[model samples]
Target: MCLRGSLHGPSRCGRNEGRDLSLDQPLLRIERLTKRFGGVLALNDVSFSVRKGDVVGLIGPNGSGKTTLFHCITGFLEPDPPSHVEVMGESIKGKGPDGIALMGIVRTFQELRVFRRLSVIENLLMSAQQYQEDKIVPRFLNTGVIRAHEARAKERARELLELLNLSSSAGKTAGSLSFGQRKLLSLASALMPDPQLILLDEPVAAVNPVLIDKIKEFILDMKCAGKTFLLIEHNMGVVLDICDRIVVLDHGERIAEGAPQVIRTDPRVIDAYFGT
Candidate 1:
């Protein structure tokens, strides 16, 4: 059994053991993605590919376009023309955020986006509301399909709560939880949709050390279960520990892309972070 079983339950263990990680096509491809805001160019021709079942880290200085690139990919902001963001070989260029999310892509914000007044479980359930069948007639009739969907969503929410060590606080308001716990809640909310690719913005920032470790464990467990992640993180230790590859951005362009060891010693990365 996976070590995570003790904390995440046996049902979650070994689900992806021997799962193929070598898919021919990249799960997500960003080609010449650029974003401009009036007089400022936020992201200038950034490009990268995230493979199936891999965790890729996006790291750079504060204004290096990491979050801007995420915004462009997830549809919060449109990329300039001639730029393409593809998932499973299909272009999602003009799709809205909802469209992109339904395409099996979901993102979490750097700031906490949880409903402050809602309970932990409620927040998660709300995140899955987009997947519910909401036809007026069906909703009015309380159709079996809708009930079953609600049940499944609740089940998944509880499972994620346990996985993140937030089950004990399931009934508490999101605003009442500690900062670290709230961070975990945001992650749980992101997973509610069972997305193929999860974009996490500063997932571990400002989180306590213990919770940071817990978050890292949860991410590794999820990756082992065949999930792909593109994350923006400044914690190099966490990045090096969890990511299969690192992409370094500087001044809105990719300056380095390689394994963790290579990124750690790359002269360009060194200069970008430490100056000449």
Candidate 2:
């Protein structure tokens, strides 16, 4: 399942025993997190723990600051970085977003950030961000490096295409896909890194019903495979269906958290989602 783990690396252990956290380690832990944009407090001392294989939902009213929190986690924003973030018990507060990704954390955007000019497969190939720079040097030297990179890239791309059910259009240019399809493509590309944890920003927003179901299924499949996710989504139907736990935010602060059934009936959640 982990391609890079199988390559040119010495392997010898009965198992990579982490924290004994039921399945895998506690892949992510957030503590006392805060964010500020000018005088606006986007997130206020929020805290949560997401273990390996847990699919937790982050929900809040529009402008309640869900996306702002994601930006802080992913290094797109640097507001009080050192005040939060821990991966496998190690602090990730000072690291840049690239550093975070390399530490086996990956995420998709609320607005898909795909390379439009690239073909579908090529776009995925570019998802291997860290490796691309290494391959570039080989291409400049007129060596087997570029050829090898292409072979591996194609192999991974094919797998992702099939996984996302986009195999039929693998060779098509990415810019031509419908908005829903583009969203799915961005998600598949994020999976190319085989991250231990992924933070999805509205993975099902603005998609057709059929595609939404497909995306929901994919999220469940990933959860069963021991992958962790912290999702930010607005669709309560989809959120209640897939999330193991729900965290509600209001005006940039955590208001409620629990199982879907409990959360759905929560007065705070109801008040936040609807009105008093």
lDDT of each: 0.84, 0.79
lDDT of 1 by residue, 86-148 (tens): 999999978888888888999889889999999999999999986433465776587787788
Spell out the clash pairs found in candidate 1.
none
TM-score of each: 0.90, 0.85
- Model 2 spans > 4 angstroms off: 1-25, 130-149
Clashes of each: 0, 0
Report the error of model 1 at residue 193, Å.
Answer: 1.0
Give the per-residue lDDT of model 2 (tens digit) for 1-276.
Answer: 323332222222111123355655567777878888889888888887787767899998998878888888777777564367889988776687887787888888877898888989888888876523244565869767667766877787786677678999898889999999899898888877678888999999899999999898777666656677899998889988888788899999999987888899999989998567
Model 1: residue 175 alpha-carbon error in angstroms: 1.2
Model 1 lDDT, full chain set = 0.84
TM-score of 2: 0.85
Model 1, residue 27: distance off in Å is 0.8
